[model samples]
Target: MKQKMLAKAVGIALVMAPLASQAAVENIQYFGYAKWGNIYTDNDDHNNGKGERNDVIRASEGYGNYRLGNELNWWEAGLKADVWQDGDAYFDTTLYLGSGESWGDVSIIQMWSAGHGLFASQPNAKVWAGERFYRRHEVHMIDIKYWDTSSTGIGIEDWDLGFGSGHIAWMAPNSSADGRSLHNIDARISDIAISDTADLTFGLNYIFTQNSSYEESDITTSGAMLSALYRQAWDYGSNTFAFQYGTNALAGGLMSAEGGSNRKYSTGVEHDGYSWRVFNSGDLNVNEDFQVMYSIAYQDKNLDNNDGEKWFSVGARPQYSWTDYMATALEVGYETVEAQNGAGTNDMYKVTVAQMFQAGKGVWARPSLRIFATYSEKNDEWNRGGDTYGTAMRNASGKDSVDEVTFGFNVETWW
Candidate 1:
């Protein structure tokens, strides 16, 4: 259905091309990103073909773990174009589609339009309606987006404040917000130059209660969140440190701080709870042949009902470029999680090494092909029966061992 809808959009655009030309409309080029890959366990009897991670038991909750060998197939692509530009006034629009493990599982992820140039004092100011992936941040190696407010609604962006630029948005709950009809407001300020070598960003989000309180039939609740990041740059690399806090229905382990409307529903419960996180990540270019990325993150979540979780993780991936288009990398990552008031703890460790063929020289180069091997192990607590992953996480022994070796190949590129 989504594919068919996009097809109709293209047809309508072609039919209106002549009228668009007369209206000063300009067509922008296409843009997209994609990563296609798979992994298989080496256990002869199991015949497993999935990416494994220590983060799996938590169902990939708060902070994510190492991504290289722990990722499956996924991709998203989109287009942007100018509707019309008449001197100080203009309009623009964007649309995109995303697919999950299977390409057939595709959906329209972004469809929005904006108008600009109306505010002469702030020529960069823009008012937009529809949906957009606005103001998102992620730790690449861990594949965790600590800050995100992407949703389907209306917003104003790029306001020039004296200290920094500012953004504000309203996300509706019709087909978004997991079908909850609550008022959601998100606001943030960024690009604040704290020093010659540092900058900062801070965001606030709120969700108003509509159904009074939580009942069997009513899942709506009031919530609030605050998030901030401090960024610094040096000659070889840059680093970003983040802190996030959320309360009640708007947070869980430092997320939903973005207001949770982008996904089908909140990844966490809608109970009265509090969540917070402290995290840091950086990418360094040691030399022409060696590059490394590292991160450390910790998050805590607790609910009034006495059920919650805590997560701590650290990982690094270092690559060496042998030539202009070839390199090798080893990724080592470790993670641990504790039930707020339940069990002791569980820990996981993983390591992977991949040989790569790429497009350019730097460690951050694009369009790379990687052939890799990985080893991962988990504590006995997770290996016990009746775990979240069940037998899928089991090893050949399947009795009390929770470890596996995997190998795979992937083609990853973005623009």
Candidate 2:
């Protein structure tokens, strides 16, 4: 029901945001992002959910989160207000809460509001509506994101289209899988600087299947995707590259375009697909007690049934400081997946070495306090244990290769 009336109008606008900001709220702000962790693994053969080293040696499932102590007990916090104004025309609002993996389960995940210069010839345009996570871009050491078009309908964005900077939205999807009745549209033309440190963007995502019984054949319920991104900045860090293409029903936007396809849309020949990626992580301060944070990724996925996947990943997380709050961090990661219908290649390698007590000194300093130990090695066909003795190990400690050892502690913060 329109997402329960937009969650009851975001709970009545956070309960009328302090009586509507005491009549025309001027400004308000608060923000947060967090990560919490707990991991313990030591090979508990079979039922792979207990030793849960995130299902034994991670990364390669929609590929993101490349095991850097893979922290994921998420959190987000928010507030941003600037209620009512009229000159440049204003209304601004933002509210986020988010939390996952328990903790009394919270929710909100942004509630929107926008108005900014309601067109006096597009005074830097803005016009918005509820629920959003729009404009997202990330790659923080394989934490993945390369443009997002989060949903909940309604949009219009920064328009200074002197060549770039434009957007569009019209969501309505929150779920679907044969339950049909979907619609999504996202478009963009971002940044576009292209020099003095580069910038460029282009995007599009379209989905359709507003079934009325497909209204008499609608191209088998359309789907489209196309994307491009390129960024470069170097004073220390910044690098990203992406490319995508899709067909048929891509409903899940684009996670580097799909290689774990279970998607079967019968006729339409599985709607061809392709993806691309490249990365270089952040905070590369190479001096002053050594600092680093690196990441490299190469992705290739071509879908149409089964048989197409190619992924390569590389990781880094070096830190060395014995002063400014103590430090020592070492994280190494490796990944390989090459399949072309033969189940022929698989690889995983990890190493985590931590003992830090940080707060400041490169690597985006953080609420760092880690005490870790991790070790990994894989390729027991990457543990596919459907056993009865179909062997993915664990028939009386069968195995040849498959190893793990983990111990964790992590805490991350952002504001």
Candidate 3:
């Protein structure tokens, strides 16, 4: 009896020891967010030539298209796990899942590792490889990822420079063709303070490709972009100004889009062109109960042998808190676009009134439920024979103008 008991105890100890050791080497975490709601519109079928059930309330900002429950619009969720860690070195991965016509699948969006003091004497200097989000910056309201350099490759971040910290990275597109590939070099200098309340950042991105699908010649195609940003912080809010310029293919933002049809210009077409943009966003606190958020942007695209396009947009949102958990808000936006070749020019405007419920009265409060009513209008050019909106409107109601009213509830939170 004693010998049998001893054997069993030894086996259990051996199993438990390995389990404990494994636990010590790995740490895991999970995070995600979901936003869903129902919308009712007066022109669901564009019976008035307004448009085909325009569910989007306005074009102010955010991933609003993700909230539409149609095949193209659906909810999103993601999971992240910090699978391993040791001192300053660790491994992590993220998976993104969504349901929609645009995204109805699971994708491993992030998988990478990093460490400090591994390559140099800088305390926080780090090096990493694999696939990652790279350096993506955006304006939340406009839904514009102005500066995105994410790809599969390697990089060094937090390298100390005399004036500020710097980062350098290389990224490449995945391809199966023999001896054919597109690669980019992205570099930036960040956190260069000019004053107690202000700072600046600068970036350069360049791309070179061999045997690209967009090229007919046997030579390489190349492009480059430059960007600068200035930021100022005050007691109540913050302000940011950003500017960018590049050749048609030089702009990294356009290249990051997956499909050829998703690109700014048509696929398999070689064109010499230039693009530029200026953008500003800010927030202001009027007092203990009132606050305002605003943004404006102007962008231009020109090709050597094609008609150009230009866009201008502005928007503002103001909120008045009735109590710690209740608030009222008014949002207004306007946008105009023109084609250089006289294809057409269109204008749009929107307004929304909302009642919000949340944990606090602050402007940044989250986990909020909002009930809203939106009103929007578009010019005849956008209603008759324009793009998708115009085609849908003409097909549905054959109208030259549209007045739409929508009511819906939305809830948003993150942790």
Candidate 4:
């Protein structure tokens, strides 16, 4: 009797498979963005002290992405694909067909399989593997990924946890010889009531690395990182505050060059120390036609006995819209860096004004064409003696400060 029942169920499923396939929707999409422009400055001869030309204003470097993907579904397999390139080489290189040379190599930034319904308890969960862009958050104006832990990894995302959700991922270096692998776990809780009109969210992330030897020193190393975030939301917009602390080997993740040998003070060595950063971002809308976005970040790191370094940056972008398609924007940014042991301090300032044409009414709307003018100033202590601007100017004219103005028009869009 049980065998008969099982056979009957299998026959019914085969008969319904065609009907179910017809009712299921399959989707594919391609999306990308492009930006280009020219910049001209009043003076183009400034150099850092080195012989290299350190022009204050030059042509803008551009970046682009080409992505194609299918919609994720529980019962069907899908593919996520991407090709990306950045920097001036993409514009300056010459094309060659069969000479074993090309303009530039296009990189596969991400190519992965993604789908949902991996677990019955977490029906909304998304499971994926292969090279991909993991969770990364950034400060828009400065292009700083304050919470960047992106890597080639496998992970499950949006796992329901009653009150919120969780994600777990494991990432490894492309080559086993580079370093040991690492695992990351992140949890986010949302909609904690702050008031009738406000809500709060909290997030925690942790990373741990396996033991590995550093190629330069041949010393075994391992490390960990912990990060926390808090956010508050209201009718107009939201604000986010975040902090991260890590050991020297894991400050910016085991694969990050920023905290290891590539750090400014640590040239080809890693030591026992600590690193931390504090960051905040705010988006506020004053009215239908006006809005503001601002971000501030501070980071400090100490390695062994080396003089620790401190960095601070703050920037703001404000815009006023006259209509859905027209708006004016002004942006100002400043950054300063110093050594804790009084090695030196450097600072720079930049300002930009732009008249923009966009398809939408908000400050965050994309697909924009902008006519812009930018002004920038650098102090004597800010990369002054290096090869580009400071050394070039001092060598040429003995100038202590460098100022520049750039004007250009550029268009950016995505679909």
lDDT for every model? 0.71, 0.65, 0.61, 0.52
Off by over 4 Å in 1: 1-24, 43-63, 173-178, 209-220, 253-270, 380-400
Off by over 4 Å in 2: 1-27, 32-62, 66-79, 83-90, 93-132, 135-153, 156-205, 208-253, 256-302, 305-307, 310-338, 349-368, 371-411
- A best-first ranking of the candidates according to their lDDT comes to 1, 2, 3, 4
When summed lDDT is taken over every stretch of 10 residues in candidate 4, the lowest stretch is 62-71
Worst 10 residues of 1 by lDDT: 53-62
lDDT of 4 at 109: 48
Which should have the higher lDDT, number 1 or number 3?
1
Give TM-scores for every candidate, taking all chains together and pairing residue i with residue i: 0.84, 0.32, 0.77, 0.68
lDDT for position 195 in model 4: 64
Best-performing candidate as measured by TM-score? 1
Q: Residues 307-370, candidate 2: write the lDDT tens digits.
A: 3456677888888988897788788888776654544556677888887787877667777777
lDDT of 4 by residue, 266-293 (tens): 2123445777878788888888999988
User: Model 1 scores what on Cα lDDT?
Assistant: 0.71
Kindly report which residue pairs in candidate 3 clash with one another.
49-397, 61-141, 71-101
